[model samples]
Target: MTSALAELSEALANVELTVPAAPARFLRLEFLEDAPEEAAAADVWSVTLDVSGLDAVPAAGDTVGLLCPNAADEVAAALDLLGAESRADRPCRLSLLPGTTKKAARVPPHLPEHASLRHLLTHCVDLRAVPKKPLLQALRDDAPLVMVAAGTGLAPLAGFLEERRARGQRAPAWLVFGCRHPELDFLLRDELEAALRDGFLSRLDTVFSRTGDRQRYVQHVLAEEQARLARWLVDEGAVMYVCGDAKGMAVAVLDEVVQTVAKAKEVPVSEAKKLVQQMQKDGQYRLDVWS
Candidate 1:
């Protein structure tokens, strides 16, 4: 007799596949700003885009695809716009996530009109929903939320915090943000400080890597707060969110988390790794990273 796998393969041998629909075109509104947040890093800036005509706006911590011609050193700058929202002026606000460079080129303050930008609106391609790479389902749970971010990684987390504040949801939240210098490189400093003062954020930790005697990244700061972090994870049932460059910062912070958890729980490294894996599987440890 034929095997079950062979029977299933034969049953679908002639099946036809369906193609997914294309994205809807959104109208580009206007450029708001591309001001530099840090004097030390001249190329790093906060960029904004105004958009309209979407069936639905993405929630906080969501991403939107953007195709801007001649914006970068490359042929075109196709970027993922973070912190998307619909504003009151019949326009949607697109806040470019922090630490973005177009082929290492500086972002101009103005967003020039391009052929593709015009065609997008004329063609009516939908960009309402962007695929989610990180799971933020923990926000819905009762567990405390701890956010770790560096450079542009803070953008989406900012949006998430704002949404939570707007909804009057005061779930405990801790933010650990790292930059080159606090005076010259801190992104959204005013907003973050206000959140802390107003009680939206339970804890706020900022790390400046360049000012210290030794170059200390966010992972170093995490190590210093290992006790608090471990307690949050093991006792409080906290959800950890990490966002940043995948090449170094994110990897380092993840290592710190596992090590701290192991020490806190008095377990072997392998067992600690299993705990991390389980957290990831259960959607408690979320990551949104890019190169």
Candidate 2:
């Protein structure tokens, strides 16, 4: 071989190749709760992904990192940044820069080493699920659980209930879910009702915010269950988890629980808050929230 051709052949021999990760499929999307025809599809669409390509089976309470389509403005800005405005759909391969790995980089960690950018977006990267935050965990079989949430915040908690069913409900659990109205956007109604019937849930309380003359919220339910809440949290070592809107719902529920503890123990509200904080520190009370 010519010297230059020999060098080219050697370089080609040194190159590495790998099969790309298999892509996950969109399995189903269910309209949840009760909502007007126009609103049901828009407001309460629950998507289920086919993640069999994943290396690990997602345990209960896991979340997939989904990369949604960028807004037009975002796409335009990205194209401008790269000076590749005309090449938005250009085929491209994906690879880590030097000194980067899946764990350290923003790319989905489980993606195959070899994949095109288009393939990554369209087919791959959908099933990349990691564990939930340490504080928010899968349902444990050993203890009673109190779950509070509003709106679609019930999604992860629903996973917990399913886990309870599949694993054989060992401990009693209570769910307090709030939504706009019993007839509009009270998500997962059939399943939740079935859960109650099958003993997957020991109790299920729902509060509607925008229906009757007297509106109710999750905190209202908590306020009425004060004695039982205290017994669950203090006496039976039950775990309490609050999820959903941080600005309003979560704050209200926290306040209500603190008041319940204070009333039960005959302590000041300040002391009760501190006691509740201790429960959090001890991993008994947990929160997963967003604004």
Could you give candidate 2's per-residue lDDT for residues 1-291 as a string of tens digits? 699999999999999989898889868888876545435333668798898997889877776565655455555565577677665566665566887645757644656566544444445533334444554568557889999999988988999998988988758799999988677687999999999999889999998877677778999999988888888887898999898888999999999988988988899999999999998898888888876
lDDT (Cα atoms) of all candidates against the true structure: 0.74, 0.80
Candidate 2 lDDT score at position 26: 64
Q: What is the lDDT of residue 285 in candidate 2?
A: 86
RMSD (Cα, Å) for all candidates, in order, is 20.9, 20.8
Q: How many steric overlaps does candidate 2 have?
A: 1
Can you give the lDDT of residue 129 in candidate 2? Answer: 41
Highest lDDT, which number? 2
Q: So what's the TM-score on candidate 1?
A: 0.63
Q: After superposition, how far is residue 58 of candidate 1 from its true place, in Å?
A: 2.3
Q: What is the lDDT of candidate 1?
A: 0.74
